[model samples]
Target: MNTQSYMTSYEILVYTGDKRGAGTDSNVSITLFSKNGKQTGKIPLKNSNNKDPFERKQVDKFCVKGDYIGELTKLHIEHDNSGRSSGWFLDKIVVTDIFDPKTQYVATCNQWLAKDEGDRKISRDLTLHKQQTTTQKSNYYKVTVYTGNKSGAGTNSDVSLTLYGNLGEAGPMKLANQEDNFEPGKKDEFTIECQNVGELNQIFIAHNNKGLSAAWFLDSIVIEDLYAMHTYQFPCHRWLAKNEDDGKIARFLVPQSSTTETPQIRKHNQYKVTVFTGNKSGAGTDADVFITLFGNQGQTGQIKLDNEKDNFETGQKDEFIVECPAVGEINKILIEHNNKGLSSGWFLDRILIEDTQGHRTYEFPCNRWLAKDEDDKQIARYLVPRPKVKNNQYKVTVFTGNKSGAGTDADVFITLFGNQGQTGQIKLDNEKDNFETGQKDEFIVECPAVGEINKILIEHNNKGLSS
Candidate 1:
């Protein structure tokens, strides 16, 4: 036998005949011997429980530690002495390596009827078995990359990635050119189809080197199996620039649980406003500028820029810090200037608003003049709050079946919709949630604010059945 086969485990099948006529118990033993005639291990086969003439029995998963350098050459069987009437018969014997599917028929004997036939012994030659090569199953994965939110700096058309697995390495897959050129605050996905490639271990990202502005600020990457639903997220909070010494960034694809918790609203009580005055047209320097911030709950009082120090002078810029006492999200901002006469209005360039608490910034650009007959310059921008840690709680009772009828045996899904346009869904299994016929289950759902839940929709595996 080869080294691999000798070191592996085996299963032996034996057949023993009934010795009822013989008084003593019918004992059968099969012994193994190396090429040098050294006795190795012995396997005692179980006797037949049935009183039939000949019965076949099997001994599964028998193992023997063999010297890898040597091979087994001989096989011997010994039967205990019986009464004077007759002797036990050895119907057959077969050996198979459990690990080797190709070497299933290691040794076989049709009928080596072993009995004291006038004190004569019978022996049969055994042939060694060889092992065969086998192949393993392959796995597939899908990788998704998300770019960061940096204004015109690191957003480019060329984003490449290299995936490494147990089998081998797979490509420097390039991301397709998107409308935004895979720019900041953009996302793109790539698929990796491989055969016999094990779990994804590491990935290397390369940014575009076409130009200095072609670099990317990568946010995160999500890798998931094509068949499996779980996703692994790798957060990269750094810039991938070709000009840097180390242009490529490598990260381990660590598995992470998907979150279903509600995202918290960002609080922007402290605000910083940077006002840029003057436009390319070179108009309106004498008019006073007025600005107002409107939030979800309330609005900031009208702020006027009348003083010469804070006036909207040509090609001049100023900064202001305003704090809001209201406890809601900022939704809109209005910018207007007094249109007393020609050249009396201000030419607006742009306004930058920063939320100190959330570390979020927004720019409202207006290139035209804020003068007479111009529409009220209202920029309707929604400043979504940063996800805050949730503390509010809710209790939900799911009815598998009511008094009217019982639901079918299937999984149940529930979705909670909030007044703020936030929604969350959870799945419940029939057996896990104890959703038997006419049974109800209660669950505690955690959210950022309990009062935001406007309604809940429940659905079952059955089609078209939802409330």
Candidate 2:
């Protein structure tokens, strides 16, 4: 072992040659010795052909003991002979420190080759390569915490981080300082060493009540792996309070840019709307619940909920499946009730709108009474519809089964038709392909514009065959 501070192991490359008359059955072993002539370990050399002459081996996580200097003192090679014509030749031995395995150590050999002729023993004095101490660098991580927009409402001093890695859960590592206790509208950055722990997989933020206010409005968190030069951001657009159900918010801090896209109308024309009536103290059942839908093109007229069974009642809820004739993207919604009198108004709690394709669901909250003088205000919000499934491509599975009197294989052809007409066609045996009997194959095809699939035409060259 060398005195290099970063060295923790050693590797040895042994080169053996099979020379004629070198005694093929000879066994050669190399024994390592400490400073006081004490044997540590023995490595037997497996003889290999001269064409491929190198055998690499390593001794990792090894340390010398006692009054010995941090180096291998000597190497002793022992040989035993078996009655054979071909002999073994010790070509060379290369020793290197684990930290810099390419740098070799210098050795003085007392006997270079071990053979069956006369002296059957050999020894060598090994000396490590003299080099400057190299220090191992630790990885650094920078964490930036952002407080919400509220003024003077910062996080507490007891804010900590839970880091998950290969070494298991490391800590709720404390992030505290007296000067700035994660104040609102302020950014606090903390640097941490990640050497002791393994690679980070996920992170969680824990908040406690130890500052000026117990409630901490969090905006976001940004973490940077300094050594890897990568950054991750976690959005926390919520409050962190002491009395909250959970004081910790966990998230995957992935590095990605935020993007926004215009919502698109789904293929189906039907939509489901569920309205929940509020159970407030002053709430009352109202007549004629009028709801209007707003889209990208234009707005719909007042669609009156005249059905008595579907009207909103205090502490009661109802759902309706409505069909829209307009073809555009839904962006907003408005709900109002006919307030016949002050005691006959609807206290709407929330309304859920679901697209017919089940692709998008929008929830609108209304915490006020409709048509109740001061509380009679319209509830509306902008919404973006999510796609239920990818509509661009569809998987078509083709089943090929032979009936009685039908052959074992057939050349099949298929044509698919949508609302607009024939979309695609493929011949299974256009390239002389064969669909084996009782077997199935799948193909992917691009879907036509959103509509019902009209029909499918399948033909086979072989007679009496069905697909």
Clashes of each: 3, 6
Candidate 1: 10-residue stretch with minimal lDDT = 58-67
What lDDT tens digits, residue by residue, belong to model 2 across residues 370-462?
654545254222333333223455576766567553333555656565664333334544233345556566766553333567888777665
Error of 1 at 187 (Å): 1.7
lDDT per residue for candidate 1 within 34-59, as digits (tens), equals 56656546556442333432333422
- Per-candidate Cα lDDT values, in order, are 0.52, 0.52
lDDT of 2: 0.52
TM-score of each: 0.26, 0.27
Best-fitting candidate, measured by lDDT? 2
RMSD list, candidates in order: 31.1, 30.2
